[model samples]
Each structure stands twice: as structure tokens, then as C-alpha cells.
Target: MDKIQNQVRPVFPFTAIVGQEEMKLALILNVIDPKIGGVMIMGDRGTGKSTTIRAIADLLPEIEVVADDLFNSHISDYDLMSDFVKNQLENNANLTTSLIKVPMVDLPLGATEDRLCGTIDIEKALNEGVKSFDPGLLAKANRGILYVDEVNLLDDHLVDILLDSAASGWNTVEREGISIRHPSRFVLVGSGNPEEGELRPQLLDRFGMHAEIRTVRDASLRVQIVEQRTKFDQDPNSCIKEFCEQQNLLKQTIINAQSLLKSITIDYSLKVKISQICGILNVDGLRGDIVTNRAAKAFAAYQNKKEVDVDDVKEVITLCLRHRLRKDPLDTIDSGTKVSQVVDDILS
Candidate 1:
């Protein structure tokens, strides 16, 4: 069993996850529309945050790419390729193409700036007296998920790099007298325990949705959590098999949702509703309103609806605006609750 475990590691299915519905929903929303921005899953330790992310990685479909491309550059992005590749394509060279699983690149706590944004390959330079842009984690994560555990502990410099890349949808690195740029668009997913530290306000605002999770409280529910975890550990294949139907259903739902989002109607009143809620909450800037609008549409699409409704707008207010709320010393109410209250006043 130990050897078997070592050879084929198994992940707990996303559908089998017992609780944290909001966390799961937040992640799913991103899948439907990555432009809704990334997700920040913050909570106490051992809350299965990372496990949920891994399960999502398992559920996502593979993507087509140019074979042997370090950046996983799509054919549509051929213009961004190096001069060599541009010339080859111009000459009708035989460039291989293939399908690969959507990458889930982990950004470790100790990752350096070079590791994140990339630098010239040091090993090749020393061994062969050659220089090449060894694409970094950001490059690998392009058009995929970028999972950052302990995101609060990320170095300040790396945070800046991520912010810049995420904002511009590209990363340019200059090293060894060579400059290279590539598409670095990705859905950023981060999880961290608040006991360690709070993330910077700037970075927090960057996440499209913020979900604060807690341990299962009800005794029976807690028991199920433990039981399912044990069963999964002992027989992951069997556990996953049991959930296969629901898993496949959810996978298809998201794929359909992606198509549905493009056609989902965004009414003018819906825009007013979003603006009113944001205005009532005193949320800074326009990000809260924008994220809420996108999230609401994504939610409608997820539910197989063709148009955005008031209820749909109501459902996502807290997740979209919670982290954007300015600190209020006088008001003791929860920020999530505040968003709910303001939403009621404006939309009701």
C-alpha cells in the first residue's frame, strides 16, 4: 500500500468535500470567468484550503499548446513568440502541437523574484557557455491556475512582480543582456492562515473574491468530514469512483457556464443595483462594483440562467466586496454582514 501510494498519489474529489460551500463556490466562479479575477481563501489552518485547490486542478480540462513551448503559448499568441519561432512560423516550419493538462503551479513561500519572473538559465550558461530564457513559475502558470499557499508570507518584491504581471497580463524579464516577454495571464488562487499575518490591503483588493472559512462545527458534520477523509486516505480510488458521477457533472457544468457567460444578459438595472450596493457600503474605487457584476453574471450562468437577476446580484455581494471595505472602528458589525445590509437597503 505504501508503494502504491508513492507511485499514484490521489486527490480528494472536489464534489466529496463535505463543507466550505462558499470556498468551493468562489473557486468555481473563477473557473467560469477568470476575468472575475483570482480568489483569496483565508482561514485557520487545516481547513482543507489547499486540498480544495488541488481538487480543482484535477477537475479542470486540458489545454492545447505548441509542443515543447516553455510558456505554453497558445497559437493565437504567436505574435508574442521569439524571433526564431516567428521566423519558423513565417517559413511554414513544422511546429508540433499537443494537448496538456491545465497547469497548477505552486508558488512556494521561499520563492525568489527570479523564480517567479524567470531569468537566464544559469546551468546552461556555466555548462555550455549558452544563454536562454528559462521560463519561470509565472510562465508555466500562464492560462492556468497559480496557487499560492501562505500568500501572506510572500516576499514584497515577488508581490510587486505578481501585481504587475496580473494587471498587464504579461511578464517581461531582462537578464544577461537579453529581454524576453510572454503572456502571463492566470487565475491566481491563494490561501493562508490569518494567525500568521494579514495580507497587504493592495494585494487583498487584487483578489476577485474573498472567502473566510472555518472548521466544521456541528458534531455530525464533523464526523462525516473525518470519516470521508479516512476513507479517502485508505482507498482513494474507491472514494473517487463513488463521486465520479457528481464530479463529471460539475466539470461539464463549468465548461457550459464558460460558454453561457459570454451570452448572459447584463441589464442596465443590474448595473445600477451593483453601483447602489457599492455606494451604500462605501467601498473604495470601482473594483468592488466591477467584480460583483462579473461574479453575479457568472453565478447566473452557473445556475443555467440566461439573464442576471436581483437575487443573483444579492448572492455575491459579500464575496466581491468584503475585502474592499474600509476599516470602521465605530461599527462593530461584520463586513460580510455589512455588505448584506447595504445590499438590502439598495436593492430591496
Candidate 2:
């Protein structure tokens, strides 16, 4: 068993987070539409970046997965399973599912490729003449969250591997005398303080949305945050209980949005505006349009609307465009500001 699997603790409630509304919204959008990719959080240390990301785990509703499958493969993913597994699933009308926590995997900076992508079980191969695989962090994170703290400082090779796996939604480990491929889909959340170092442009481009946060400067707000933290530490069970009702409501909201997302629609005019805004900003590719479209649909669903609106577009513009904007020598404004300006020009 993985060490992380062994070390379990209660996560703080998402409702307990004091501020950073944008961060919270962005995370919810991703849950509604994983196709928006994942969010990159660049901020000051002790700003609750990690805490907010971790709290997301508990708010998520439990997933129904294969009872005996370590990969947590959903029943609908039978086509992606191995031949034997597919046959087993097909033959068994008695297929069982167990509700498990939505996995929240922490990818430490010093992790190795084999550790990320699993390794062949050498003991089984040598002693029993049977080939077996030991799953890794990426496998554990399948269909869930893969969170990297201090992502900017991660090794280049590891970053590249992460980028590839994140892009393809699958991982293949061919070394250690065994080859294995599995569904490794996950929402890739990364956070780092910009003062430490800048993220590689390649990896930066891989993220679907970007949010920059700072420590709360308001005296009263800071005091509120401290009190919340103190309460959580003193009696976590009570603290979690206090927020349980809200968490349950939020969880149901997310679940409803997931099912409603497919039915949400946008008019051609709004779609054109999405394209034009990205064009005016000179974003590198169609990724901006796709992310914006998906985000808007998610926002609409979250709001219990069947069709997207201009407000939906406005709500997610900064997050979708900030990281994808191209730099110009003459433009000195912040990326978020630039996005806001273009959105205002087009949608106003």
C-alpha cells in the first residue's frame, strides 16, 4: 500500500475558507467541467493555496468505482479496461461498486518517474514467476486531483512527464521490465509563489486556468482566518460538523451541475464573442476558446440555468485567458486586467 494511503486525516471544510473567492470559483468550475483542464495558483506562501486545494477533496461527492479494481475504474470505462477485465465485467451482471473518497493526490517535488508512473513488482517476478505492477501516484490520482505544491521548482524532467500525462489523460510506464498503461485522467492543480521561481512556459501553457492570490491584508479578515484556523485545530470534528450542512449542499450542487453541463447551450453570438476576445488578445491557439466555452457552460449549469449568458462568460474570462495571453512590449497591464478590458469591450 502507498504511504499516502496509510496517512489519512480529516480535511478542512471548503466553506470554512475565509476569502479568495476567485480561487474557490475556479476550483468549482473544474469540477463541473474537467475539460477546462486544471487551475494553476501562483501566490504568496501561507495564503491557503494548499489548504483550499486540499479542502476541495472533502467537498466532492463520493465516486462509484469497481469494487476490486485498484485503478478505481468506473463502469462506463469498460472499453479502456484490459481484455480480461472487460470480459469479467461483461459476464458479471453482478458488477459491484463501492463509494470511495474522491482521491486527492499530493505530488511532492522530489518524486521520481517510476514513483509517479508505477514500477514492476520485482519480488513477484523473481520468486513467483508472475508479473505484477505496483501502482504509483498518477494511478492513485486517476479521475481525481493531482496537486503539486511549489510546482515551479519541480525538476524539468518530472514536469515534462507530468505535462505529457496530463495532456493525454493516460500514463504508460515501460521500464522496469514491464509495460503498463492505464486511465490517468485527473484535474492537475499546481501552486507556487512567483517570488520563488517562474513556471516553465511549456508547463504553464498546459494549465487551463491561472489564478494569482495574495495574503489577506484586511485586519478583520486576517483575524477571522486565524480564528477559523484555531477552531479547526482545536476540535476538527466539531469544526467539520459545523460546516457539514453547507458542504452537503455544495456537494449536491456540484453533482447537479455535472449532469446539467451537457444540456447547457450558448448562442452563436456569445460563441463569436469568445472567439473575438481571444483573437483580439492574440492568444496562441484555440485552447482559450475551448476553455472559455466549457467554463461558461459550467458556470451556467452551476447557476441552474440551461443556457449560457454573457454573465457566465464574464465570470470565467479572467481565469481562462490570463495564462494564455501573449505578451507585447507596449502592454504593461496585468494579464487579468487585459482580459477584463477585452471582455468589457466585446460584451459591453
Candidate 1 lDDT over residue span 216-320, tens digit each: 789999899999999999998899999999999999999999989989987998798798878877788899989998999999999999999988888887899
Candidate 1 all-Cα RMSD: 3.1
Off by over 4 Å in 1: 1-7, 77-87, 121-131
lDDT for model 1, please: 0.86
Candidate 2 lDDT tens digits, 1-348? 333542357678999999999999999999888878899999988999989998997689878787777677787775335333566767875668788888999998889888888888777777998768888998898879999999999998888888788778888877556567887878889899999987866678888889889888999999999999999988887998899999999999999999999999999999999999999998887888998999999999999999999999999988988988765678779889999988999999
TM-score of each: 0.92, 0.92
lDDT (CA) for every model shown?
A: 0.86, 0.86
In candidate 2, residue 234 scores what lDDT? 89
Task: Report the Cα lDDT for residue 60, model 1.
Answer: 82
Model 2 poorest 10 in a row by lDDT = 1-10
